[model samples]
Target: MNRWFAATTAAALTGLSVIASPAAAAQNCGGPDEPAAIRFAFAQLPFEPLTGAKWDPTPVASNYDPCATLSTILVTVEGATGSSPVQALMFHHGEFVGTGTAKAHGFTSLDADASSDDTVVLTYKTPDESTVRYRWHDDRVVMLDPAPSAE
Candidate 1:
């Protein structure tokens, strides 16, 4: 009976460890308003490309989910000349992965469709209007659609 008790206790402890592990804790993407998540997203922005740009104090939109393996924060930053460019900051497990649009250009507006947990559809209101889908694959944010040409 003592041996059985020991085995049961060990099994239970092992299960608890797995539950408390970071991998398990990261299962939920957490809320969009999570302070830590917001800070992480802002810290990852490519400042070189966004020099002299001003963005809202708050994020326009955000999505998080570990099942999808990708998370995102959308921010609209206006340049000194009044050109508003919407930037998609990508993340994986709360770490900044990359930007959805590589070029530094202005778009009239931007929207994100995160209907699926694993991928996000970003639409940009440019002269022609364009859409791009992004996902986390092979440790990076991969654009499923053709990237927009730099203006």
Candidate 2:
């Protein structure tokens, strides 16, 4: 009787509840359901993509905006020195846009030197706008105004 009771108790104690899943974690960093208009602006620092594959791939910023007048850009990278994410507010012709932040994890150049000029790249897509891609250089966020392509 004692052995049977002990086994039952052990089995009950071993039972585990369901916790967060991979799909839930991916939602925070731009999941597939998220809108494409979401934009992310980063500093002039190279960063690796969040791809699960193990290879040198084109690092992409899933959340990026083109028409939105970025006022600030924040960056955060682990295992790197002299390269810090920035929080900048930009004004073009006197207007306001949304805010964003960036982080470079497991990146090669980002891990080596994230502060170098003309290294970081921002990529995003929009419904009305073509795929917007920009590279930071000369201490400036290359602003790309969306224009309708005559097809």
Q: Which model scores highest in lDDT?
A: 1
True lDDT of residue 64, candidate 2: 21
Worst lDDT 10-window in candidate 1? 27-36
Best by TM-score: 1
> For residues 1-151, could you state the per-residue lDDT of candidate 2 as single tens digits?
9999999887766542212443333343333221212122222223434532222212222222222222223233443343323222222211213222232222111111222222223322223433322334344556343422322
Clashing pairs in 1: none
TM-score of each: 0.61, 0.20
> Each candidate's lDDT (Cα)?
0.62, 0.30
Q: What TM-score would candidate 2 get against the native?
A: 0.20
